[model samples]
Target chain A: MNDPEIKRRGLMLVLSSPSGAGKTTLSRLLLADDPNITMSVSATTRKPRPGEEEGVDYYFLSTEDFGLKVNRGEFLEHAKVFDNYYGTPRGPVEEALSDGRDVLFDIDWQGTQQLMESAEDDLVRVFILPPSGQELEMRLKKRAQDPPEVVASRMAKASDEISHYTDYDYIIVNEDVDMSLARLKSILTAERLKRKRQVGLSNFVRGLQQAL
Target chain B: MNDPEIKRRGLMLVLSSPSGAGKTTLSRLLLADDPNITMSVSATTRKPRPGEEEGVDYYFLSTEDFGLKVNRGEFLEHAKVFDNYYGTPRGPVEEALSDGRDVLFDIDWQGTQQLMESAEDDLVRVFILPPSGQELEMRLKKRAQDPPEVVASRMAKASDEISHYTDYDYIIVNEDVDMSLARLKSILTAERLKRKRQVGLSNFVRGLQQAL
Candidate 1:
């Protein structure tokens, strides 16, 4: 099924969902299940927390170095959340792509837009939605990451995020976790088959023409 | 997971390929495995062959009836191939769609373009590509349906068909039948999850807001 003989360019599998819609969980499942894909390690100016590896975790960078790379157009999309700068470096991603491994993106709609603008053909966007508002609120409340007031604001933000649903190539109403994971895998499988991503196709077609 | 409660709109899963690329085989696999999809039946001016059941195989029509339907704009896409008229009838497809059943189209690029123009959002086009020109010609010759001259013309036509690779949303290289079928099913699975196709999403979202 992997089609080892034919080389394929990697895809930027961008996954965007509201705080409680379980996109992070889906990303983890995809990474664990598929050997052909890996997490897109981000470059960050913020200090790495304990139990984090340098290359394996975040590519921890000095603030000055991060800013310089941003200026040099090395980062695909850079953003300042509060004081810390987090960005995706384009070089490693491109290298991985040519090496026939896909890079998974866990980002919001804004980062997806930037990626699309830069590499429209390389990107596939999927937006996850909770089956119901009640279910969404219930999940958020269960997470207990924020206070009630914060949860209210998070719900508002979720609506704002869901408004951009049309912008994504696919949407999954994640009612059941297992089913959602299956759908995500299917998307990845199908995206790998895109003609533009298969760099060996033109040559292969020509070879077919010559064979007969 | 089939969300039965949500009356989802069906997708027009169009599979296109150059002659001898095995789209028909793939389509059969898809239909046999999935009960949610059915073949798109066409109305034609040409008489049906032996064992061709009306309504199941095709909607048989007289020349006058075909012309009247054409004038009434009943066809999704129609072409005058040689002297006979063949076209996909719109009503049955739409009815099947609203009833939560998908319609599959096995066609070439020209018909796909017409479907895209008329219902871009509803149609999901996947092009099947042979693994190699060598493989393509070998498959054609193996079929033994045409003479050498006919095969040469078909090979030329295949080259012309492959040129329109960029037009398709997805492409599957039929290097292995099982893998290619898996990719095709994956495409259908993902396309079914599109937010626009899930007509009940807005109402579900609104319900979520109200529950909050």
Candidate 2:
């Protein structure tokens, strides 16, 4: 038989950053542009914001339900923030990965660590940083979602978050949207081709030898 | 003073395969295409082949000289193949990596193991396989340098080499040259962006807070 088709185990890519660092935008762009990659929808106890859909943007769950799932080990990674619990559902992410798809995580440093510790071999973590403190403040203020004081608090938190950048597997400086996106694409493309991911390679070669 | 440009260590990528599997060709392509990657030239006691230049190809060394260097722990990795001694020099490779360049090793399985044991954190191993045994035979035969008997013997040896495929991090089937090249390029590009390799990411992000 032709060497069995090399099927790769799915990969978990964590993109971590402080609030307003453009991870969400980059994740959206990645999903839209790459068919091989799929975004991992999270489960949250937090109330849905305007125009949010259950199971699409997130698995909107009650606090009790969220707590129950967490207890059942149904989360790949989980964290508490702003008086609400948020987590990556175990089922969907596992399904997507086993099907040879790449999953993106737009999460915090804690979530990144949790997933990595649990699945170090499959996890690729990237920490994104704003180009400059001034730019970070500009981006946060531009959002118009937060008041000046809240924005300042986020800026303060950013310094703390950036301190952990070395813990990630890769880092990207979001100086320009296009450039950062390009770099991200290159990284994903290259990672997809890693030898460990190409299980079919050996069998493919065997087939070639048989044919020859 | 900013982070002193904290030079990180270099990575060692070992590409191994049976003769005629295009390991050498792929290594050359990778070296020529990537300015940041340098080939780890082996110091050999064997005489140079036609068209081979000293230093550019192998660092021609006497057997006694090679033995002395090996005794002194001068080689990062080395081996004796076919009654001739061959080994990768230590200084140049280390220097290249300290300067942020990646080094490629075109060595066999034994040398690959030594590298893994010596510099496990910095090593990425790739194995190239012929698409089929028949294809392997054809490739061996097509190399006008060898006779039919030699081709058959090489083909016999290929099976033994291929049995160790599981030890590799990535495997490539030499089905089509261009496609394989594309795959190879992707692997290198992805590896270059690995989180562990970006030594200054943390400090860089910390610096960004100034912009805020």
Candidate 3:
């Protein structure tokens, strides 16, 4: 809205929440409201769906190519599950950052960890939390009413995700969608102004010094 | 204006700038706009001005009493300059912090460094930069067309202040006052959400986990 671009490098705004905690909805609202940020398109070994575009949806990759890229450390972070590999490639993220346009990441806690390992300072992690466990279960049940054991496993997974909440830079308890989105926007606004993220900072400081 | 009370510990928002960079104006605007935050009333050995009240303006102190308090580790950070003592007390700050009421600090880089040493995690440092050296000088001249050497000394002091700009967690170039205040508000909002600052967070997390 302000559109005050001082020519700074962007951040990896990693949003991680348990499946029913409204992470996707929050991400959508953020991208819709702000033109300065863009979703980070990831590469995947799985075949693209019919409607999905190559760059728009996913950078669809062959298993061999994925493996080769992993070997070369081209991906910022990657994971292997079942028969396919999915990872955020380093190239496009770096390109977006240097252009002073932020990249939004909708990744799990493990992926967030990997990103942090690779690029610690560039990443701003915000963990989304459900208001209550009952609300979380209700949302999950609406999606699918599974057997007791399955429900137990889902709870276990949610617990696992919640355990990593402290690993994030900020936390947003999703009591209301609008409020959560507003908080996310505030976090983004604040992170953008961090001194290290401003690529033009050194030069800007130098100019100020010369005038003094 | 939105007094959404999700009780949490507050942060020490330290604002530093060179003399001509408009720190006082930004501080006054922020204080006027936000009721949830209050100025960090410092303890001083200097005499209070005519309109100033004892506790509200400053906790007026004698030289001996100030030295005793310093010895007792009561002040978070304090300094002596030209026979006058000024310090932020640890007790009052801690009380305000636990009650979810933020404290604003308008201090120089030296005071900031001392505060950082004592309460590193609780502090958020923001440095305001003037638009240009020329602008800074013009403002200084307007304040008083002092001798050339005095002007030179002021510029040198400003340069020293600017050199520590990198030491802050965030930087705001005061090109526009309203924009800078908006940015400051955003920073405060985001900082309030950090899990560590939210003392009730563990209980909040527990409640969520139990529902799952």
Candidate number achieving the greatest TM-score relative to the actual structure: 3
Clashes of each: 4, 22, 0
What local lDDT does model 1 show for residue A47?
A: 90
The pairs that clash in candidate 1 are A133-B208, A208-B133, A208-B134, A209-B133
Tens-digit lDDT string for candidate 3 (B53-151): 998999999999999999999998998889899999899999998787889999998899999899998999999998888999998878787999999
User: Candidate 2 on B1-212: residue-level lDDT in tens?
Assistant: 01234345567888899888888888888788878788888899999999999988989999899999999999988877789988888888878877787888887888888887777878888888876677677777888787668766777777777777777887777777777777777667666666677676556655676665
Candidates sorted by lDDT, best first: 3, 1, 2
Residue A161 lDDT (model 3):
88
**CA shift at B106, candidate 2, in angstroms?**
1.1
Candidate 1 lDDT tens digits, B86-126: 99999999899898789999988999998887778888889
- TM-score pick, better of 2 and 3: 3
- Clash pairs, model 3 backbone: none
Q: Which scores higher on lDDT, 2 or 3? A: 3
Alpha-carbon error at B179 in model 3, in Å? 0.3
- Residue-level lDDT tens digits of model 2 in A13-36: 889998777888888888888887
> Candidate 1, TM-score vs. the true structure?
0.90
* Candidate 1: docking tier: medium
- For residue A22, give model 1's deviation from the true position in Å: 1.5
Consecutive 10-residue window with the lowest summed lDDT within model 1 chain B: B203-212
